[model samples]
Target: MSRVRIAAEIAGAAVLLVAAIGIGAFLREQRTEPQSPAAAPLAESLAAPTQRPQPNCAVLGQVTPVPVPPLATVDLANGKKSITSAEGGYTVIVPTAWLVQPGIIEGTAWFGQTRITSYDPKTLPRPGPEAPGILPPSFGISLDLQLWWNPKGEALDQFAQHMLIGPDQLAVLPGGVVSVGGKQAYRTTIQDQRQYQPATGPVITTRQTRIVWIVPTDRNDRVLVAYATPGESDLFPEVEKIVGAIVLTTPASPTLPVIHQRDEILGRWLYDKSGAPIAGRRAEAKLLTYGETVAAFGGGTGLPRIDRDPDELFWLVAVTGPDLPQGRGGPGGTSPPTAWIMYEAPATNDRYEGAGTRFASAGTWPADFDALPDRCR
Candidate 1:
């Protein structure tokens, strides 16, 4: 919603684009770490397969696994595989033929016939703020998915209704609850307008419908899965195939525990709503993984290694002090982040000595950025 952003290509996402969920692969859990380059297995040796790092929201520390592996490396031409959201701590068994990639924003990921790459969501060299009636094109037809925490514990249908009003959205068809993994999921379709004018040809216009599905998790978090395609495509079967197989957690899956286990870790540093560490404790923090950070304000090049992820969102929070803060950095505001150096768990605070980080939050990203009053931006 700012001049510069990586995701949120669609308009009017009031709360739709704030992704905060992760899913494993088609395997959805029951561990089986994928193979790596150097650690080739021996012919007759029994080393017990390398285990996947238990998914969790604790400080990842300075040296996370070198090849954390690109977000979506395994391309299944056809079959099944596990896709983890890592951010939201969920897993789904999607069709391997689908190219899986991180969602447009953090706490989100998606699968489809095409992969979104080679262009910047923040700035397109061709010039953006694209004309109306024409939605930005993607690699090909894709089904995007992501979910944010549901604080008030709203019912699935209520949440779906709130997600339908996008900026370009033209109409909302009636929808109702459907079964997915035995869970009640709200399914609906929004009529959206799009167009394209080529230099050498007449303007090409196509009718597209954003088919959306909203499902509630046992965790009180709501998940949104959308596939924007021509109105004629019958995606219900495939969509059901993907959403029907979601698994929230498995015995082997590493989960971001509500509280970090180690106190010495930056997570141990505690703070109050006013942004101050407990009276005698020092302030400290660490960078966040998808599960704890927003893709728009995510990792970028040239940033402190500690503060960068993939650099999707090109915004930085700069608070003047505890008294007069600026940017979307204030609680209930939309500021990016305040600390990179010292932070508590769920780690995405953008912080420093004068600025302390908050461990609790109403939502991720702006609502959770720590050190809201100390950074210079």
Candidate 2:
């Protein structure tokens, strides 16, 4: 985690990232294609909507209605640079002075400096494609946008409830249902400690509040838009304006038909324990993505009966744990899946409509479940 500091006096935030693409392709291929005009109406109706009424999402206990600005708000005039995450499936604009670093999780990360004036150069390495490297004249706040891999395979609202802390801290998902970036999203803010260094200076530690927006990309996938500030509330307004400029693409994939990258389960966490959220904990459970060829139910048969719904209605199933045993998936192998961790058995999803409820059949999940399995609740 790298902190933000652009000049001698000003402080900034931290750098964040996440895993990359593959499930994106799997998700696209599973869609139902429209064969008739009736289905076309349904598909066309779901066009990249800029606004929609609040949904019945109560999993987080309540809905904090937040208005989303138009995607058109993001443009060359408002940005120095723009970053898109194949893993997260979205794009965000940041200040022109911010340094962009490649992060496996955050896709691309940045030095959290809001503005750059002058800096003291030191000996520290700048963050790059392979590391959370820190640069000179900086330290303190952090910002990241990652697609949170849901371990419990629950709806976003439900997951928010389980992960919620009181308020003004990490897991501040009181607003599980928010609309931003031209898409429906989940909002949370976390204040935590992190360390960063100047070019030639010793490592420094600081506390900052990170506001996160968990936006669902597709079935079993979500992207987190996070901005950390030097103080609790100093940068909220500024960060809000930055995030408000986001515009989510429909289907949320950078590429279509075929995704060249594999959506590997870069890592898994045992969403167990309590207290401070546990990170980098060994995963005790495994997630399996199961999708079926939903046959169209009508009088016609054969070719005429198949349906086409670009939207994929899929869910993850908790499978044998400790290893990527499903198919040819391996530990860090190219074949592993990066999706949900079916937290509870016999869970149901309504995305399939008449497809009926999905049953996990049987499995054990942490819950006594929490993201911070390493720390005690």
* TM-score against native, each model: 0.43, 0.35
Off by over 4 Å in 1: 1-80, 86-89, 95-97, 105-140, 164-166, 194-206, 224-231, 234-237, 250-377
Candidate 1 yields a Cα-based lDDT of 0.37
Residues 281-315 of candidate 1 have per-residue lDDT tens digits of 22222333432333213322111111222211111
lDDT of 1 at 367: 34
Give the per-residue Cα lDDT of candidate 2 at 45.
Answer: 28
RMSD of each: 17.5, 20.1
Off-target runs (Cα >4 Å) in candidate 2 are: 1-79, 104-140, 151-153, 161-173, 193-207, 221-233, 250-377
The window of 10 residues in a row where model 2 has the poorest summed lDDT is 11-20
- CA lDDT of every candidate: 0.37, 0.33
